[model samples]
Target: MTTHAPQTPGHPLPTGFPAGTMILTRRGLVPIEEVIAGDDVFTHQRLWRPVTAAMRTTAPTVRVHCASLASGLAATADRPFLTRVARVFLEGGEAGELSSAGWTRARDLAEGHRLASPLDFGKPVPVPDLPASLTGIDPADVLRTAGNMIRLKGEAAAALRPELVDWLAAQFGGYGARRRFPAWALTMPEELRTAFLDGLVNDGPQRDQFAVRMHSKSFMVGLRLLVCSLGFAGGLSSQGRPGKPGWLLSWKREGGRRPDHDGFRWHPVTRVEHGPEAEVFSLSVAEDESYIADGIAVRNRTERLTSL
Candidate 1:
C-alpha cells in the first residue's frame, strides 16, 4: 500500500491544477474540479453561476491533441522540448452556443468561443499575448525570492557574504563563451542575489554532496531545488537525452521527519517509455519505482510533466 507523508505544520503543498482539467470562471482559468456551484463562470463577456452540477454519461467523450507547435518544431530539429500543459474545459451551459461545442476538446477550441478572461471590475478583459519562449524557470520562485530580498532592511541585505554571492553568480552566470545566464540572475540586484543564494545554503543540509552538486551551476537545477524546497515534486527533461541527465527533485514524502528539516532528494530518470496511448509517457526512476504521465493513471507525477 502507498503511504502519504504527514502534512507539515507551516508548509503546505503548492496550489495547482491537474493536466487537462482547468475551467474558466470569473476569477480566470481554474481547475474544473476546483469550481464550486456558486462561483461565477464566464459566458458572453458576463458572469453566470451554475444552479446544479451533475455528472452524466454521454455517447462520445471529447479528446484534444493540443501540441505546442514550437516544441514540435524543436523536436524535429533535435533541440530541448519544453512544452508544458494543464487541462481546461467549458461548462455545459457555456458549450451550448458553439456549433461543435459538446464534448469539444482543447485542440478544437477556436475563434468566437468565449473563455473566462481575467476581470477588470467584473467585466471580462482580453487575454494578453505571452512570450513565445520562456526560460524554463518557475516565475513564482523568482518573484518570491526577489520579494524576500527586497523586504530585508539595508544592513541585512548588505551583510551577506561576498564569497557566497560570487560563487552563486558564477554558477548561474555561465562559465564559457557559448554559455548563457538565466534572465533572473542577470537582472537581479547584487544584494538580492546574495540574499537568495544565502537563504538556500543556510536553510538545509548543505553538507550533502549530492545536494551541493544538484544545486550548483545551472539555473534550471536551482529552480528544481526551489520547487522541492516548497514541498512539491519537480520533474525535469530535455530532448535527445531521455533520462540520464534529467532530474527528479522532491522532498521526503513518506518518512516521519520534521517538516522544517530540508531533506531534499534527487533522482535521475533512468528510462522513459511511450505509454500505450498517444501524448503519454512512463518514467522509470529505479528498479521498483516508476510513474506514468498523461496516461490513465489517476495521480500524475508532476503538474508540468510532458513528453520530451
Candidate 2:
C-alpha cells in the first residue's frame, strides 16, 4: 500500500481473500494455503485498482481477519498472532524482554508516528497532521517490535518460530505505504554495494538467521532494523530513489521462479514513512527478464505484521 495523498477508506475484512481463491498456477505464485495456517488467519482483498498490461499489480486493500473475541469466547484470543503479541502490553509487563535494539526502535517509533500503505496504518488511513507522533521515533524499533512480542526464552526468536518470523518477514521484509520505494529503488553507491554484499555473506548463512536473496544468492542477510520515513510515503513520489543506491545484478534461472528473480533483481530496497501508522511500509522489486519489466516477482505487497 503506497501512500496516497488522500487515502481511500479501507474496510476491515473478516479475512483476506479466502485461503484458496488462487487456483493452481504454473508460475511459482503459490496459493496462500501453501503457508501454514495454525492461527486460523485468512486474508481477503478489496481492489482499488486492477493489474494492467502497463502495471504488474492492482491497488487493493487486504484485510487480515481472525475469529472475533468475546468474553464468552476469550479462548479465541489465542487464534490471531497479533493478539498474542499484544498480550505482553496487556499482562502488565515491561517490554524488557525486547532486545536493546528492539527497545530503542520501539521508543523511536512511539515518537515519529507515520504511515505507509493504507494496510500499514489500518482501514481509513489517518491524515498526518503536525503531531509529536511524527517526531524523534526510531523507525527501527517500530519495525522490530510492532505486532510482535519477543519472549527472552531459549533462542529469543524461537518464541515466534517459523510462524511469526515467516509471517513478519513476508509482510514487512519488502515494502510498505510510507516508503513508496521498493527493492529496485534502493540506490547504494557502487563501493557500498560490494561492501554490503560482503557484510551479508560474512557468516555464510546462520541456520537461525534470516536472509534476502537474488539468483539464489544471499544479499543483505541478518536481523534487519527499519522504520518508515516520517509523513512522506512512496507511490506519491514522482521518481525512484533520489540517487541509484545499489549495483544492478542481472541473472537467469531455468527452473521454477518468480519474475523478480529474472535478469531482474535489486538490493537494499527503499523505506519511507507516510500514514498515521508508520508501520505502513512499501517496497518495489525488479522484474524478471522473461516477464519483462512488469512481472509478478517484481510486484509490491503490503505487510500487516512483521518484526525487525
Candidate 3:
C-alpha cells in the first residue's frame, strides 16, 4: 500500500471529495480521482471490499470540523457521515454521554453532534519472510541519513539504525519532511510490526500508552494510517487549530484490547461551513456501502442528488 495523488479514472453519483482527497485503499492512501473499479478499500467494518464503481462530480461541499478532527472533512451537504447525538436528558445541552449512532448528513451536523471516529484495529495481513538486507549501502551514508530522521539517543538510537532508516528512506522518501510507511512495512509480519511500532513509540513520551507528537503533517498522517492498517486503533490530533503545526499520534498497544464504542471514539463537531463548489469523487463498494475516510465512517450516495 502506498499514498497517491489525484488522477483521472473510471464509476456514479455520491457526494465526494475534491481532487487530492487521500482515500484509504488496499494500496495505501490513494486519491479518489485515481481510484478505479476492483480496487479493494478499507471499510468501517474493518474489512476489505472491492470498489464496484467510481464517479467524478462537481458539487457544493460543506467543510465539517470536529473537535478532535484535524483538517476536517469536505463533502457534499447530503453525504452521509456516521454520527450520533449525546444522550442528554437536560434541555438543549450537549453532554459527554452518547446515544445510538446513526448516519447524518454533513449539512445537518451541528455543534456538539458526535461523529464516529475510527479507532478500530484491522484484520492482519500475513507476510511470511522478511526482505533481505541491502549489501552495498555504506554505514556512514546510513548514519548521515539517520541524522535527518527522527532524533534518537541512547538505546533509542538503535531502532532508527542505518539499515532500517536506509531501507525506509529508499522505499518511502521524505525522511525528515514527510515520513511515510514503505509498502513492505505496511504489511510486515506481526513480529516486525511489533518491533516497528515499539521503535516509533520510543521516539516519544511513553509513560502509559504509546503517544508521540511530530511537526510534520504528512509524517503523522502516514503513521496514523500505518497503525490503523496494522489493526490498531490510532488517533491523530492536531495540537493547535487547523493550518497550525504539530500533530499527536497515539494508539493502543499491539497486544492490548480494542477501543471503547466498538473501536470508535465520539468526535464532537466543532464547525460546519459552506465550502466552495469544486470537483469531487465517490466510490461504490460491494456489500458494505461505507468506507473509512480521514478516520471517520462515511457512506457514499446510492442515488445522485441535484446541486445543493
Best by TM-score: 3
lDDT of 1 by residue, 1-308 (tens): 21212223444221122222333333333333344444454332223344122111111122312111111100011111111121222322122222321211222333332211111113323322222332364544443343233224234633543222333333333222212223233224434343454443444324321121131113333343333333333233322234323222333222322111112121211222221211211111212111111210111123322210
Distance from true position, residue 209, model 2, in Å? 3.3
The pairs that clash in candidate 1 are 19-87, 20-86, 20-87, 21-87, 22-87
Ranked by lDDT, the better of candidates 2 and 3 is 3
Full candidate order by lDDT, most accurate first: 3, 1, 2
CA displacement after TM-score superposition, residue 134 of candidate 2 (Å): 7.5
The candidate that wins on lDDT is 3
Could you give the candidate ranking by TM-score, starting with the highest? 3, 1, 2
How many clashing residue pairs are found in candidate 2?
44
TM-scores for every predicted model: 0.22, 0.17, 0.67
lDDT of each: 0.26, 0.20, 0.61
User: TM-score: which is higher, 1 or 2?
Assistant: 1
**After best superposition, candidate 1 residue 88: deviation in angstroms?**
26
Worst 10 residues of 2 by lDDT: 68-77
Please list the residue runs of candidate 3 whose C-alpha ends up more than 4 Å from where it truly belongs after superposition.
1-13, 87-97, 127-129, 133-160, 170-173, 176-178, 181-198, 201-219, 225-259, 303-308
What local lDDT does model 3 show for residue 99? 66
For candidate 3, report its TM-score: 0.67
What is the C-alpha lDDT profile of model 3 across 89-149, one tens digit per residue?
2322224466677788899998657776555346654432222564465433342334334
